[model samples]
Target chain A: MFKNGKCIFIAFILSLLATPIMVAAEYGDVLINNYSDEAGMRPVVFPHWFHRIRFRCKVCHADLGFKMEAGGNQINMLKIIDGEYCGACHNGEVAWAVENCDICHTGKPGQPTQVHQSTASKLTTTTKRKQAESVE
Target chain B: MKFKHSLYILPLSLSFALLAAEPSWRTLVEDGLHDPTSPAIGVLQEPASALSLLPPDTTGNQVSWIRALREGYIEPRTNILPETKIEVLDMDIIMEKTGELSLVMFPHKPHTEWLDCANCHDKIFVEKVDANPINMFAILSGEYCGQCHGAVAFPLTECNRCHSVARSSFTGKPGVQPISVSD
Candidate 1:
């Protein structure tokens, strides 16, 4: 009985170790738990790869004054709608419309559904093309 | 002995009383010492001459002194000093008593581009004047401008490079007159 209890304890430790790796793999979306005492609102998970393909480093970094440090930009919902920060480009013209609540605040736990997979893929491809043109 | 035991107890009680009284004493002292400088201990003073080195204001120019200093800049210096010739503009300014003239113009922009911000911001300049006391003596002792001017950028051995006075021209400042070089 003692041996069986030891094995169970070891298994529990192993599962704890594996959980963080699984969390990191799901990088495309982030969970914002705002209701907790530490943070006030649900944070929208931002996909880095999606934006990297669309813009140059200088555009959002140097021009937009986004800090070199990650999560350094103090963004709020009001700022986005005013087309100041992320709204400057993501305002329907470049990516998705700010008015579309479900696009960002999707009630899901992880990556939101891309509305239509066909249109999402086309957008990604066009963005990649524009990035290439700017580089050249 | 009973007397010795009582003596130890007495000193211990006194010490405890002093410890308990410390907070109120500290508050009283802080209230008495209230001043702007009291709150900002160890904050360095800005140098008076910090902005004196900059060029004079030209009409209709809205550029800040820092931006003007960065203008006409070349790439920052790295491992190897690029073999590009530069034009040195000669100008005069009164530093102190007795018209103490010197070779004021230098190829500053090229060197500035290569340097990191920290290289000069805190070390070379005090956040505020009179906060970090700097003088020619400190500079000669390997502080501020002397940190690199004589060591890495260019040797202070060249006299005319800094002190362009006619008398000290031979030993302190050397070489030909200001000549332009092409990339």
Candidate 2:
């Protein structure tokens, strides 16, 4: 019984350590809601992971003039279409077009379903359905 | 008697003329429009040119504190590697540690110029909003900011440099003023 209790205590400590990691994973992944709610549209889930892999931090931040603070950059659909903000690379030829709103606007602010569509698909049942519904 | 009256009348008329010659609102407006060098000009309002206000090396460098510390001036070097490149981004994250204390203004541009993303990301600071507690106590003991600040970067003694979010109600304590680049 003594050995079992010690093992349980160590397991508890390990779980506590893991909790922060889970939360930290979501960092830098921003919810771009500059004018989304005001315009009756969903806020965008701009995955830093997705973009960071393909491009250096300088590409979007320095050359493309993206503010480091998420949503700090003045991003608009019109600007993207004009090849200004997200439009710089999201033009049909370079990457996915800005017309694909559902890709970025996958997260809901208060709802538990507020994970990125790409990640949501891999997660359990509810988030996957949420992504599908958002597409629809 | 006629000469005395003429002298008094001449003086009174001249006085009125002088009073009228003093600049009117109309004249001031006209002067502002026509004269680019007028006191009313926006740029001229500041006595020194914008470039002159910054350090010589940082004049056109967009004011990176990290760069100024490393290359512009020398001090006791830290073990950590310094960042290269002159890239600057003029954005600040205002962190409200406590309602009583002033908020911290985290400027990223200069830091990014010096260090890689991995240096602090996920390790020291979890690149998320409202994630790190980042209190002064922890910082003093060598946690979040103490990771580099006291060790290599500017020491935490410079309190006002980070806690520089402007608040109307705040009557700042000594050494708690906003970080001005001129210093």
Candidate 3:
């Protein structure tokens, strides 16, 4: 009985150590917003993990001089479409075209999904590439 | 029972007396704080030539450039100019556990030239000295002096920077050793 109690106590300590890793794994989404004084403004969310693998930090942050703090960078749709901020890279050659608004805006709240099937399919292709590289 | 009640009341009465003796809010604000005669605001108010490359709107539809410029550049000037008057403060480092305080005078002006005002102001030394609550543990953990001493400015590996002279009898661990003064 003494040996069984000691084993249970050791297992409890090991479980406590594993808790932080499990909590971190659950967090995978990114939240981004252009600083606005307006009361209600839906900010765009850019997935960090998806972009980090494709581009370097200096490409967007240091090169563009985006502030280190979140909600600091000033971004507009017109500036982006004109190949200024995100448009500089997402202009058909790098990722997705800026003409496709639904790709980023993701549509209004409770609205029907306007799916960009081409971008979604391309994402799968990139994921396959990453998996293939990992296997090697 | 009466003695115990008086003991508790004594601390409460003393605290009330101390509060009554404290300066009023208006007096504290007017005289106690470091009221600079002419506080120099760092960063240029006008748009510099570097920012001229940004696109302009013809109809004034876009946000004002001046407003954007002001929001971006709000920093206080550090008083470390060559001609400015500076006072050096002596600091003590315990070499051993003798409870003895050694004195090493710190130069203000030269150090300010290399650091931004935010680097020390409100962080290491508060605008008011009595308001400063610097924890040595926080400084060692990279909150105050540790921010630059170990990074871009200098590495705090040397022993003589803060201590200046080695004490023959002292024995306690060093707080934060000064890095290279020179670039």
Candidate 4:
């Protein structure tokens, strides 16, 4: 009985480790899930590095008016077809048209739009020696 | 006979270039009119002349735009509208919310050079100082600074860039307050 319980514990721990990797995104994959879950569709996992391959930062952020945050822009099918945000380029003109539903929206369900490898934890890596003196 | 062979190559290559759907949109989407690859493809016109022609970087995107801009290789327009006025504000805010890590010094000079105030104000960060809840965990989840630092900007690996101020030498700047836990 003891050996069986130990084996079960080991199996449970292994499963826990595999869960994060099952649908893990790469470093620059941004999973956007604001409206996707409610609409019964998979969240869009935008490959930031892929787009960066050809364009500069200002091309999308400045000229195209894309907000920096995930789900920052009110992206939807109607707005996309009408020539806004992604539709500006993906509208069967410069790049491939959004005919295939699975192209952009292929993230796991219920994942909030976010960067796969963001700077959050890395920023806190260094332990503080002392807190700064408070100003009166 | 040699001249005839050369003539055959030119048309052959031109056909291949024109066979693809409309000229690439690298520079087209920005201004709807500039297609550098077309017409000039035969002459090997630097398509996307509007963009810097620098060789793509091996690490990040093929183009090192920040370096290109900083080194004055290219001049990108701040806005699509030519006549729109751009206001660049200079403000420095400090955050002491970090437990033991160095205090964060947030500056607006470089950011305003490229972005409008609305890009972050009241959206990513609250206009009123200390109103927003900021922490490394929230940022890792793509909140606050994480939205841009990891996505577009220089990235989060360069920690000292933001946490530059040493607690001992920090005399504090005017009009700036430190971020902390309580209201």
Candidate 5:
């Protein structure tokens, strides 16, 4: 005795859950999990907007040598500690020091590296938050 | 006397167990304004303290980043060092290899507005030409243009935006699609 409209709506929502799609993320936001997931840490959720706001693209892209592709850059903890990549500016003086691991390593565990897309951003609530099968 | 002591400890242990639980902070990782100061008293802020003052856009990251630039909402430095000379490459590359659809126009101007030549030259484009033969499938799979289009720039669904040049207008004949895409 459910309303016809309500029944269709429920079915539609359930069908969405049954299907796995790309995880929606904010534009420019990236989840770096090249090593974090395997190393027993949360994926590093890099908010490009935050960094780009203060610095220009070349500051990181060219100068810091970060590739355009997500997970493309082979970033590791050792390299950062060696004053490269993120460590270039993240040193004590230019920006916050790297002692607070949680500040950057904030993504859900097991999240793969990817750039947030527009299509799925709306469906973020409906997304299963599963591994990025939709990507690779 | 022992029974009275046990009675006091049971609730105490239960409350202690509950207090030891870790709180989830998932939202902090999501894309939003993580404004700590609350300086903009006018705009609405997320409970976790993100100010939504940026212009709203429907597609690509859901924020009109370019519009924000035009509005003078942000001024991103060319580099950490303010003295570094910044250059913009004013050029356009047409991909006549697009089958049936209009030719794809890759504009260096707009791209250089946010990025430098080094960002794409050797890494993404690799000397332009068909050296890195590109196709819609490759782009859709997040390889070429798909790197930014499907993710942050604009979804590939806006076909006409890139495929702007009409095939009929070309001088001789529109170039044929490449037989095999080089790696």
Candidate 6:
């Protein structure tokens, strides 16, 4: 009975810790759609987990000038091709070529991209509105 | 008539002396500390010269917060915050009415200069929105912002510095929701 209690306690602790980790993992799967869907291309489902395993958060976030918040960085195809933002690492020699659109843009049609521009804008507007309302 | 003449002469001479001793209105403008036409311009002007001031000794024992930050003595240095680009985020949190206190205009740029996101994230403060109830009492007791802010960081005594956001500006208006970037 004592052994069973210990096992249950450990399982409870593990679940408590794992619950937050499971939630955080979702943030890693960011959708890069700065100009994809807007320009008739599918939005890129950038898997943060793949990069995070090899590189530290500072590598892309700090060294490469990627904003922590999604859609915060004004990334464009021209900028990427010019070897400025994503092109800094996604060059033919470093990681992958910018020409590889299929790799990043792996979203299906007929369904709205998970990271919609309108939703993000609405969130910002809502936050601002809520703040303004509190003061009144 | 003689006494009156002396009195006038004395007052005139003193005024002349005062004008000669005082810096000219033009001189004050040249120093970038004044604008005769708009007195408020001086207050709005950036103190670019402040950076030129020599940094104090930061030996990890006793040191001023501003001096320590200026001299690059804080942790989570280049290895952590490799970005040279300074991102200034205006994080304005409107708290429940407690007393007559100005809202805090948290300038993220300055803190990011010396520390990384991890310095305060997930440890001192949870990344989740509306998790921490950070108040002055909790801060003084060494929680949330108080973890670094009063210990190695800037002291809480400097009220106006953090609470610089004018209360009148936010009065009767909703405040901006706190932005949480999950780490």
Off by over 4 Å in 6: A1-27, A109-136, B1-183
Query: What class would a CAPRI assessor give candidate 2's docking?
Result: incorrect
List interface RMSDs for the candidates, in order: 26.0, 22.4, 23.7, 11.6, 6.7, 23.4
Give the top-scoring candidate (lDDT): 5
Candidate 2 residues lying further than 4 Å off, grouped into runs, are: A1-25, A109-136, B1-183
- Residue-level lDDT for B69 in candidate 5: 61
Indicate the DockQ of the complex predicted as candidate 5: 0.20
Name the lDDT of candidate 5.
Answer: 0.65
Model 3 lDDT on a 0 to 1 scale: 0.38
Could you tell me which 10 consecutive residues in candidate 6 chain A have the lowest summed lDDT? A20-29
Local error of candidate 1 at residue A111 (angstroms):
14
DockQ of each: 0.01, 0.01, 0.01, 0.08, 0.20, 0.02
- Per-prediction TM-score, please? 0.27, 0.32, 0.27, 0.49, 0.65, 0.33
Cα error of candidate 4 at position A20, Å:
11
Residue pair clashes in candidate 3:
B95-B170, B95-B171, B95-B172, B96-B170, B96-B171, B96-B172
Q: Which residue runs does candidate 4 get wrong by more than 4 Å?
A: A1-27, A31-45, A49-77, A91-114, A119-136, B1-65, B72-77, B81-85, B128-133, B154-157, B172-183
- List, residue by residue over B1-183, the lDDT tens digit for candidate 5: 999999999999998887555221223323332222222222322212221456655555445666666576777777865655578866666678778999876667667777777777776788746677888777777677776776667787778878987888855433332222111
TM-score of 5: 0.65
User: In candidate 1, what are the lDDT values of residues B1-183, reduced to their tens digit?
Assistant: 999999999999999998665322112112211122232222311111222233333211111222433452112222221332223223222122113556333333443333433344565665443344544555544566555433223333444544444444523322322442211
Q: What lDDT does the true structure give each of the candidates?
A: 0.39, 0.51, 0.38, 0.61, 0.65, 0.50
TM-score order, best first, reads 5, 4, 6, 2, 3, 1
- Model 6: DockQ vs. true structure: 0.02
Q: Which whole-number lDDT from 0 to 100 does residue B116 have in model 3? A: 38
Q: Chain B of model 1: TM-score?
A: 0.31
Docking class of 1: incorrect
**What clash pairs does model 2 have?**
B83-B114
